[model samples]
Target: MKTTFISTQAVSSATRLSIMKMQAELAKNSKELGSGRWADVGLELGNKTGRTVSLRQDFARLDSIKDTNGLVMSRLDGSQAALEGMLKMAQDFSASLIGVRTGDTGADVIQDDAKNNLQALIASLNTSIDGEYLFAGIDTDVRPVTDYYATPVVPGTGPKAAVDDAFLTAFGMAQNDPAVINITPAAMDAFLNGAFAAMFDPAAWTDPTTGWSSASDQNVRSRISTSELVDTSANANEAAFRKIAMAYTMVTEFASSNLSEGAYQTVIDKAAEIVGEAISSTTVVMARLGTAQERVKNANDRMDVQMKILNTHINDLELVDPYEAQTRVTALETQLDMAYALTARAQQLSLLNYL
Candidate 1:
């Protein structure tokens, strides 16, 4: 025991190592207190690392779904507004046609109104959001309708073109020809209920390249939730839109007081029937859209609740107790201050101090 003595260098090295260790711990405690999160999450939750990681991933997924749902809600809202506008316009046009008095002047004015409404209806059908056409089905990049006024309505392609072709093919006369007055009710009815009607048929709609089946009505769909998918878009080729197109095509292109009473009455009667059918079809579409919107909203609400719970779980896994961390930080600071004072004092002392 008398022969054993620790060297000065050894004492200094031991003191420096201890001070460095305390400083490292103090820095960690300070970080935990300042950031409100654990400084060493893996060390704190060693066995629960897998569970915490999974929870954080789930929380991230929920956030992404919420952002996507917001966009979907906006699109659905816009579609509802456009559909309602088209419905109101259809209803008004139908009402106007019921008691219309046909004179040269009145007929011309009616034609002008019909043309305007047809263009309006087309504009509504081509509604888009963020450069995505809402009525273009899976083909969102392509516009659903060509501009009625700008482009020539190609035969066998578009609504107006088909109507124009049908008028010529059925009566063997151009639209608004005086000879149309000689056409019988049976003939007019056959044409209206046959090929002219077929032109608007959803069953006949097809694209050569995409081959989007008309049987599905060409509505674009989106997966709104993990398990539920919804048709986010409306089909412009639906019965309601077609009926409005047909009526508008007739009044705008075929209205005439020069025709006999029978031919003029035929236009009025056919249009009224189609318009009535349109109102019914529109009501059904509205109901369907309303149901879809409700589904989207409900999913959003559920996800919101899930996100809050997930965030709490994630915090429990990664966050520090502020009071506990603050207490540790204070204690570490006091220890570090003492260690520095001792180290400084130790460095100033030497073996030849008491000569």
Candidate 2:
């Protein structure tokens, strides 16, 4: 019989190596038990790890879109509220014009109300959230409308100065000139339809030297979902906004009380027509925004369902059974304790102890 001699040092080294391996497994199982997830997702899932990776990416994308849709909805709600307010102002101004069609309401009262409404309209267009103007279209950093009543810091660079220049260019005189009484309905209508209308054009209104609005013609667009992109902002350069400005300017700047009866009637008639168009256009814009809001909401609903399905799939691939993990952890701990006790006993086994 051949006897195999193994040194005590070799026996102790082998026991220690086995104990270290069991300790490592114990640590891994302990973590899995606590977290209820696989300790090594890539190791456990192997080639199918790519599927979880793709699903997780899709889940993250849907979460990002859902977050962005919240902001888009906020902007749309703000825009709708502002447009509704503008529509109300147009309705009230139109009613005021009708009240004065019989020449019963004082011109001064109408002029005062028009000036206030114009200022309010500009303020509304310049509405902002976190320093971003809602009606600035894609030019969110810029204010959409300039204050028409603001005194020009420069000689000919203010919104009021631009109006004055247009008025002078059209009529050969200032707005307050006493000779305005001699202005005929034909000449006033021509001026209103021509030079005055041109002032609110997107190109002219964005002119650096003399402009009423700095808003972009292109509105802000947002992706509400993986497939849906929608416009999320309004622009001050919309014809509805321009017409409201024109109607308000006609009453405020035309020296309404000084005009001949026929010319005053023409101004009122033109303002009434413009106000009606503004109201109709605003209603259309509101309806479009409402539609966008509904689409965004639906997109979120669909994304939520997709995310839930994705999470379930991911959990199946990446999560561990906590009860099984805990049982393995308990077994490994018992093995480690026994292995440590044996390793210690093996180290203690020396011939000198028997001596």
Candidate 3:
């Protein structure tokens, strides 16, 4: 080939162009090494980094929901435990009446025994968790058991009456605001003189201290519940309580504390059945609670799965791939070194040097 010596200016220009191209390539490779992506994202999540961050945020939110579900389930489980204990107590009471007789128990003794159980039932109704009463109707702040006495009344409170002739009302019987007082239904009845009605009477409640007197204390909700607890003439827990109470009463009446085998058997059988009812009630509650627990667990499991998937997606979008990144880094380092050397050489270039 003919001698083709380029002018110094031309060589310098060519070197400058080459250096610029090399720098652009080096930047491209270095980016890939640092970010693990082949290219930059425009506006959309066209790149993995943006997508990964979104996935990570979603994962964290789902985990929080799962934790809340678990807490509710735990509270349900604790309530189940309390119910189980109540069942055992019911069973023991009935079992004592197998072959017992009324005469064997004292007249007053039967009433007293039932009263004690009623009190215990009241106690159970007052059960709470995390400071909230379980059976306080809509008012969870108050205890369920207020008293064993009578209904409360504001003085001179009359029956609800119509205000006009069109309304066919004579007078309005309105209770005072905050009318609810903590007195037993038995006692409240005496205050209101409402004790004569047999519905409010627990035949087994006859103690002079616990009698139908004005001294009773009870919550409004608890008072209302007393009617349900008392055995009605239609269907009564009275016989059940009465039978057991009588058995104990007889022990006092008779010199013998040992009940006859026949009597004991009868009492035991009744007691057993009552216990079964109590157990069934408790079991149903527990089963419902368990269902809630299951839901919580399922939520947690779902959250866990979701979080993992989100994490993986997030990783795909944001994580640097070590293998690709390292390769790019190596190439970039070489280009950077070459660029520095070329720049230095170009600066030193001269006509004499070429000669």
Candidate 4:
């Protein structure tokens, strides 16, 4: 040790290494100071890194679910609005039917209102948001209801055509036939309870070409939270819609003015009854949708709380003290400056200058 000699080259190499290390530390501290987070999270957390990783994953999952729940809530809101509008239409049409039944209004007024109501109903059920039909159940790509007033109405094709065929088949005559005037109330009732009712049955209503509804019976189900799933949509195939369609079709398609007073009153009475049932059924559907909306909102609230907690834990695991980081940065800059000065002085050293 007493005889040891150190060369300029060895001293220069050591200084260069020290300068590189100081530079790296300066950059790291600067980053930490700017971001207020660990410059190297894995290195800083080391053995605890897995905990932050898991927490981040959970946070991301909750965020994704919250976003999806937003879409679900939008769909539910649109459906509720559509159902409410349809309910109002049904109520108005029912009132008109009652007016006709009590002889306070003319039958023609009810017939015109029924036609308008049916068109409005079909339009409402076919409502879409973001190109997705709200009443299509799980078949979002398909239109839920057939337009009874759709132009170029072909025979044996579409809901209106099916109604026509059912009428002719049951009564052995067209709705506008002169013989309809002599038709008894019992015959009309039989037809209404039989062939007309069967048209809205699942098998017939689901027919691809001529059915009234192409929507699925199973509604859309959405995961509102990690552990909670709920129905987020309603289908046009519900019994309430079916009854409404029947009531509208009976008044709009039947030649009511051609019928005797007794048979005409029979139609009005039955249509009014069906409209009442439809309104009640629609109310139940709205109540169920309201419940789902409440659940989704609550789930979102809980997820928000969970996400906040997760963020706090992640911050604790990864955040750096800005003051400490700035102090380290200042120290590193001072050391780097000294190292640079020493290196510059060493490079200027020469035996020739001494000679």
Clashes of each: 0, 0, 42, 0
State TM-scores per candidate.
Answer: 0.85, 0.89, 0.43, 0.90
RMSD of 3: 15.1
Count backbone overlaps in model 4. 0
lDDT of 2 by residue, 239-297 (tens): 88988988998889883777888888888888899899989989988888899999999
- Model 4: per-residue Cα lDDT at residue 165: 82
Query: Which window of 10 residues has the lowest lDDT sum in candidate 2?
Result: 99-108
Off by over 4 Å in 3: 1-50, 97-116, 136-142, 147-279, 321-355
* Model 3 C-alpha lDDT versus the unseen true structure: 0.44
Candidate 1 steric clashes: 0
- Backbone clash pairs for candidate 2 read none
Q: How do the residues 9-51 of candidate 3 rate in per-residue lDDT, one tens digit apiece?
A: 7767777787778678777767767666655543325655556
Q: Which candidate model has the greater lDDT, 1 or 3?
A: 1
Model 4 stretches astray by more than 4 angstroms: 1-14, 102-105, 151-155, 343-355
RMSD value for candidate 4: 2.6
lDDT of each: 0.76, 0.87, 0.44, 0.88
Please report how far candidate 4 places residue 16 from its true position, in Å: 3.8
Q: Please give the ranking of all candidate structures by lDDT, highest first, separated by commas.
A: 4, 2, 1, 3
**Candidate 2, overall lDDT?**
0.87
